[model samples]
Target: DPMVMAMLVDKMQEACQHLDRLQVRISDTRSSVLVTGDLNAGKSTFVNAILNREVVPDDQQPCTALFCEVKSVDQNDGVEEVHAIRDPEAYRRDDPTTFERLSLAHLRTVVEDNEPGYEMLKIYCRDAHGKSDSLLHNGALDISLIDSPGLNIDSMKTMALFAQQEEIDVIVFVVNAENHFTLSGREFLRTAGKEKAYLFIVVNRFDQIRRKDRCKRDVLDQIRDISPRTYAEAEHLVHFVSARKTLLNGLARSPSPMARGAMLEPASEADLADFKHLERCLRQFILEKRARSKLAPAHVYLSHLLSDLRVLLAYNAQRSARALQRLDGQRSQNEARALQLAKLRETVLDRLDDTIADTAQRVADDAERHLNRFLDHLHHIPYDVTYHGMMYLWRYADDLYRAITMRMNGLAAHIQTEAIRLSSAASSVSTVVAPPSSVSSSATTLAHRDTLGAGNVPALPELLDRAALARMARGLLPGLGALAVGLVGYARSLVAPMGAGAAASHALVTAAKRPNPLARGAFGTLAFAGTLMLFYVVADFRRPLEQQLCRAVGTHLRRTGWVRRHADATGRRAARALRQGLWRFQSDFARIQAEEAVLATQWSRERDACQQRGQRITAMTTRVAEITEQLEAINLDT
Candidate 1:
């Protein structure tokens, strides 16, 4: 995005460099008249018509590939020659190395060859007409007629530079009378008209037009659209004449040694008169007002540059401000998200710990209290065991104890797992966020938003991988209990769409059908005790003895701290898992915040750059407007 800003603003920066150089050029003694128009528009013929000689080559083919600046021989120490400059930027009129010398006769070959090697050809020649009639013989000002290649042949930038060249005092736009204005011609006139407001428009080849009146009217209409001032001064500024005829007439009037084509059609009286009139007006505009005309290009360049500068400055300022706004909004969002994460770490994490601890403690207390009460009711408890013998009594008794313990443990663990699972489900969160566009350290800032985005999925805690404690109570529960557990798991899979508890009843009914092997083996002990009770009629000792054994076992398990240990282990696992989730959320949140910090730095640099550019733009705008006013205020003291 910064590149976008640079791409748009680089032109303005380059334009700024020209202002100082242009200011210096405004005070120069020499004046220049640029001759330009569409391809095959007879530009070279027009120049030849003005000078009344074939100083430049002209033909039906597209020639004049480069600029041919025609000036009086006085600048070349009264010598007529060609200075073919390969590089215009390094050109020095006095320095012989700057340009290659060629005979004046070689001008035609150079023009026709479409020389890509040279930037321009400087042609110095003498005027054959009397001093009074000669436009180039002015003693007060030196004017050079720079004939340029046709429009669309040169780049727009090069054309603009060519148009605003330091010494350009006036512009003469030539258009074919029969062809009228091409798109390139219209654009050239429009641009030239801005620089000097006044343009000398020569509608060439007038002798060729059949509908002379209509052609004039159409040309005026287009001129009015592009250059209102030229149209308003149509009588004085516009001319219709055949340049070839004028050239021929000049040959007839005062033939020069340089003139070629001795046999030529004489110019019509009307054509000669019109061209002479045009010559009179142009000579006056160029020489008489040379001092004032020199400032006009600067005035126009500044006027247009300032107008465009304002637009560019406003656009960059607005875009930079919007980018800053987005940065601020992004910063705020990052802060809010960070705070949310902090809450999870500080407040929510603590709440999770308390919830897990309370649930575990409650399960532990319930296990201890209810278990002791179950053991206390051992005398009243029912059993399906039939007395077989004393041999398997201990085996059956141990099984009965294990079954009760495992049942209680399974219930407690189920509650804990469900609680922790719900907690994890409740606390998880996933949110996606995009980072703001950033500015480069350089002056270029992205005028648009960035596509690189940020997102986070907070790691949710799951209960740590704790093995089932009830599964370890193997001896007490029948194989059917294991089967029941598996059945419950399978049922959960089938009825999962309904909910977790949907298939619980199916597991319980399946468990009820399977009788423990221990129950059948324990019946012998019960039968032996019953026979004693019948024979001696003493108080039955089975219930009291089992009660005594239950008390002893409960007391020993309590001493070992089995209940509290399970509860604490479960709580520790939940806490550890919850802590891990919190850490993960913090890690992700920190990364996002770090990116925001980088963007913040970029925004800082961007804002400063934009402000500086905006300030410079403002200063330049004011300065250019003032300079334009100053130039306009300058009066011709001549």
Candidate 2:
């Protein structure tokens, strides 16, 4: 949208270029005077008076619709010609009277008929006898008198034709003295008054007023009251002149008396003097005030153009600034969101790792406590060296294995609980990190499991097998060692008592009255040696058997290591699943960040373009201001 506006501004710049060229041509032409007023205001009659000839028709009905240009030419033959030059170049030529001549009577017929085909009529004349030398004397600039159509009736059509003409140097507003400043006349004055042109308000037919001085004073006062700005002062702006008297006086001054009497009207010396003064004022304005007249129109056009351009440029700059500001705000919001997501990603990952580690540690500690309790129960059982004792030990080992298996399953459930928590966390945070469409059902569905009972908890694969339980049972060896020590102590207590009884019976049976001391001493020494040997054998077998029991216990309990391995495997699996979900979230977040980066870059480029456009507008505004200042500084009065 702004691009289209930029194109419009460019077109305006081009239009200004054309205006500059038109202004140059305007400055080169003779100062033009456009005569305007309401119907029967004596506008055409006033033009005829100024030219000192009855060229423009003046009648009761409307006559002139097209503009008429009258210029003085150097013609010794005293011939006058009128041409309807539609071509614009004709106005530039000194002698544009080369076209077909239309009689004054035929021109009157065309005006009365109201023919719209003709654009303008050019009349070329010269003073062969130099009768009106004071008016168009030497050193006086050539003047073009343009008579416009009547106002208030068919005003639009009339004004449309007037707009087609070039710069108007002066406006001669002719008002009938009898009516003075009609509604239509005031409206026309207000419209034309704004132009930078010399305005002259003439109260035509002053001779008709019964009290000339009073009527003229009242008319001047009324004009000032209506529009004071139309002229510098009442005296300078108002003129009282009878067009009939002025025309008749000029005719009387003709070289041939017969020609003068034929056209002259009856007029008093006072009417003649008033006409003379009006003529002198007009002549001075056309000559002495020439510079002001030419520059005024140009000054007005440039000033207005510059002012409009300044307003348009200011509006464009403000619009551009507002657009850039909105873009910047959006970019900031996007950046903040991206940062928030990044931080969330880090926090979620950290929490997930901590949860997994804590779950694993709890499972390991639980398995160890269960194994220790099973070993304590096994240690207190009676030792039978027979097959029955061995069967009992195997049964105890099997029961312990079942308990470890159940504990490992509980650990698996705990791990699943933690995994579900992680999945729900990922699901909830996924909505924040990415769109809902990106989340997989598997990851999100886990959160719904919270509403279900324990029976609804999905079954997990076995964590501990027989081999794993056996590994866990290895830690029960110290209890088995204590069992071996008890067996050794029982055997020592029974054997020590029996050995003493048999040795005492053997001594009684083998004893002689007074007994051979050496023989008896040898028997007693041998019996004592046998008893010490038995004790030594039992003591020596105790440590070896205890070591054997420890080995057996270690072999059975080693199966429990399978449970630890299963827990580790389950933890790895869960961690992997959680990691996969986290990775998906991370991937989505990364893409979001990338998209934000592109958007930020796009906004930055647009902002830069707006800034450049603003700079250009500022530069153009400065140039326009400088041109306005130069136009204002020109001394048109001098």
The sequence of per-residue lDDT tens digits that candidate 1 reaches over residues 1-638 is: 89987976787676777676667767666777888877888889889888877788887777888889998898889999999998888999988899999888888888778455777899999876666667676666677888888876768534754555444677888888888888877766666666666778888889888989999889899889988877887887898888877786667645565345653556778988998889887876676665546665666677687677667667766776776677677768766866765665565445655644554454345444544555456446665444333455445445545443444444444535443553354335323332221211121111111210001111111100122122222222443344445445444433312224636656554545544445433443444444444433223323433454455445544676544554454444444544455445546656766876786687678767766766776676677678668756766435
Off by over 4 Å in 2: 1-18, 74-79, 85-99, 114-117, 127-140, 152-156, 211-228, 253-266, 320-417, 424-573
Models 1 onward score TM values of 0.61, 0.63
Which lDDT value does model 2 have at 85? 57
Superpose all Cα atoms of candidate 1 onto the true structure and report the RMSD in Å to 1 decimal: 21.1
Q: Which runs of model 1 end up more than 4 angstroms from their true locations?
A: 2-6, 13-25, 36-45, 52-67, 84-91, 97-120, 128-134, 147-169, 182-198, 207-211, 225-229, 242-273, 288-297, 330-398, 402-552, 555-638
lDDT of 2 by residue, 116-234 (tens): 46667776665332544533334345566778787755767557634533456677788888887877677666666555544677888777788887887777676666566555545
- Best candidate per TM-score, number? 2
Q: What TM-score should be assigned to candidate 2?
A: 0.63
- Residue 213 local lDDT, model 2: 74
Clash counts per candidate, in order, are 11, 18
Q: Tell how far residue 193 is off in model 1, in angstroms.
A: 5.8
